[model samples]
Target chain A: MRHISHTDINYADLFADFRDPNSGAVVMFSGEVRDNNKGKAVTHLEYEAYEPMAEKMIDEILNAALEKWPLNKAICVHRVGPIDVCGCAVVVITSSAHRAAAYEANRYIIDRVKYEAPIWKHEFFTDGTSEWGQNCDCSSPSHPHHHEHKHHHAE
Target chain B: METTIQVTCFAGLRKFFNCPLTINLKLPTAYEDVLLEMKKVNPEASEILDSCRIAVCESFVPRTALMTSDEPLFIIPPSSGG
Candidate 1:
């Protein structure tokens, strides 16, 4: 029933909201924080978001996922705040009559969510270096924001 | 009528814009029009002027989306977070 939560999402309760006898499979995927950042010691992560807009974009993706897949239950959870290594950063759960829908819808949700979601995270390195990951693929050449034919700067 | 917008920037974006996390604007006009007007308030707003993605009421909307919708629009900078 919960679409998004700023606090640590109770992922178990979230998936239970859609559990039904007819649903044969429930697949849950969690992306956790890793302590190693390409051989460098990783510290913690700090995430931020344009809350209102991020929520709006999430609903659109949810609607599209519902239409494209035969999923009876879907839950997407993204954490915004500081998190230590090995903590759950993102969670996606889906239920269907078969494993295929669960697998496909889960994949679709993860990929699309990563590319379209408006959340940002700053990776703190043990050596005092920090880097940010781009949340959207809007910079892609095929993006609608791109000029139809001209290959100009991707703002 | 005046409306407010909250923006959160990431990555190198913070280096360009000072870190307060959010900027509140009260503009007596439409969403698209307000964006143009913002520059007057802070010349630095140009960093997000035309290229930023805007979300209104829990949904990302086109720049052409009307400002007179049922809910006030919220402006967001390009997302550079994972």
Candidate 2:
């Protein structure tokens, strides 16, 4: 499956594909757009992606996860364009014979995709002002400066 | 002869430059040369350019990496997609 989507993501349709009889565990993660960020009242978000590169990078992340973990299936879908508050922005699913591999691989894929994918988010606020969303502050050691100067989100 | 590299900008760089930009440089141009040319066109973009990463042929390349004309370049600012 392709990594990026321009329309709203249907979680049910995505989850239906993971019906592997041999797989004992399926882990899914959905990153939704919240109504607030950094103390600002966010109205919505517009996501843009360098489509070709973003697809390639997400594919690489999924492939690497499959190689690192014994999995039955792995898939990720990220939405672009305008997304309303509470809208699903991205989703990652991994199925394996055990829960540990499924859980670990799901986390790895989401984290890597967030840092490595060439997708940008533009945030619109209630005060009639907007700004480009800062990239995540948790920088990978390999590309420590990639997210330089961005504010860290306290999870 | 001069070589033209078409650069696709994203996020803040796109909004700053208004659109994708093309820069003409001598052959065997390094990634930094493109940024330099961009700075010449839009001096105000220098700060944003400094923090940007250049991607060639779908992969991020170091500033010193040589660029070819056929491969469309991408100027990626900090990405915030989750």
Candidate 3:
């Protein structure tokens, strides 16, 4: 299932649930909230999404991944709302009969989710300052300063 | 009869239009018209909205699309979530 959650993601539950007798490899990826960004001390992050569309898009990404890879199971969960430093923000799990498919599919799913999902993040710094993230693919191409700003490609 | 469309903003626009969480637009509206309204009400938001992407009925659409009152409209700022 693809989900946008407010609570922390449970790694143990995800790993256990993704297990399959027919699959020999299982790959899991987690995105964590870091304490520093662009030289500023980040205190926390706030995430938001157009819920219905976000979930639907995630399902589409998974479907694409399944078509491209021989997969046994796959699931992704992302968090919305405030997340503290070192906290988990998103998790992806993929299981396949071979390690290569599992690894490649895992990477494909996360990349599509970050680039295509409707979710957005706003960061709060320790100095009582906050800024909206502007690294999405949806940013206007006509803006003069748009290209000058560096984008944060989700890693 | 007059028609009003409800537009919801998230992330950056949320902080700008958070008091109501949603803004109303008159019928016979296009994406550009909405941006103009934002400029009139909050100039700062207009700057941000200028670079934002818009969605109608939960699907991303071009700024030139004409919108009616019954469909859901969303103003999306550049996303950063992973």
Candidate 4:
């Protein structure tokens, strides 16, 4: 399910759909908002998306991952609007016959989603300030190509 | 005839522009022309606009690509999604 949700994400319901007997390995990555970033105390996060393009981009990313790897299934869900600290911002799940494919495909999907999707994150600080978070600095020549993990943790 | 296109802004651009803005340009307008018009509307956003990419019909297009007035353009800043 490549979707943009306005409410909280239900991880249980997302995993319940994966009941393929042929799939022996499943990897899930969940990204949550943290209490601090860059030494600032973050109060919450506001996520916004160009809904149509964001969904289409996610679909493209998942399809690309499926094509690049031997995967049984791939799904991603991202939340928009305001989210509190420790709240789930995004989730990606991939299942395959073996652990390696599942793990690799899961990483590929999340990385592309963060770099390609038309979603933006705005962080609010405890000191009554806020700024737009930049997850990927690919456009910058001095920065590395990899995306900076902003509290993303696997589950 | 003049063509009017609506640009949907997000993140920092949205904070500066407030809402989707409409710009009038020539029939065969390039993506760069949109940026020029945006700069004319608000010079303060020029720095931010320089870092953005324009998407049309759900796909990212190059600066030299001709833009259509029928489809809305999305000004995407560096994505911060997980």
Highest lDDT among the candidates is held by which one?
2
Per candidate, the number of residue pairs that clash is 6, 0, 0, 0
Candidate 3 per-residue lDDT, tens place, B3-80, comes to 555667777786677533344666666766776776677877866777677777667777777766656567767656
Of the pair 2 and 4, which is ahead by DockQ? 4
Each prediction's Cα RMSD?
A: 5.5, 4.4, 5.4, 5.5
TM-score of each model, paired residue for residue: 0.68, 0.89, 0.82, 0.89
Worst 10 residues of 2 chain A by lDDT: A146-155
lDDT score at residue B13, model 1, on the 0-100 scale: 51
Q: B17 in model 2: Cα distance from truth in Å?
A: 1.2
For candidate 4, what is the TM-score? 0.89
Clashing residue pairs, candidate 2? none
What are the per-model DockQ values?
0.37, 0.54, 0.52, 0.56
Model 1: CA > 4 A from native? A16-18, A135-155, B1-12, B19-52, B55-82
For B1-82, candidate 1 gives per-residue lDDT tens digits of 4444554344445565544334344543345565564555566757545555555656656655456533544555545433
What tens digits encode model 4's per-residue C-alpha lDDT throughout A121-148? 9999999999998766544685435442
Query: lDDT values of the candidates?
Result: 0.65, 0.84, 0.77, 0.83
When only chain A is evaluated, what TM-score does every model earn?
Answer: 0.82, 0.88, 0.85, 0.87
CAPRI-wise, candidate 4 is: medium
Model 4: CA > 4 A from native: A139-155, B68-70
Clashing pairs in 3: none
Query: Which of the predicted structures, 1 or 3, would earn the higher lDDT when compared with the native?
Result: 3
User: How many angstroms is residue A88 displaced in model 3 relative to the true structure, after the best TM-score fit?
Assistant: 0.6
Residue-level lDDT of model 1, residues A1-155, one tens digit each, is 34445677666777777689989999988878889776888899877776665666667667777888898878777888988998777788888899998898887776766666677778899999987754444446754442111121234
Rank the candidate models, highest lDDT first: 2, 4, 3, 1
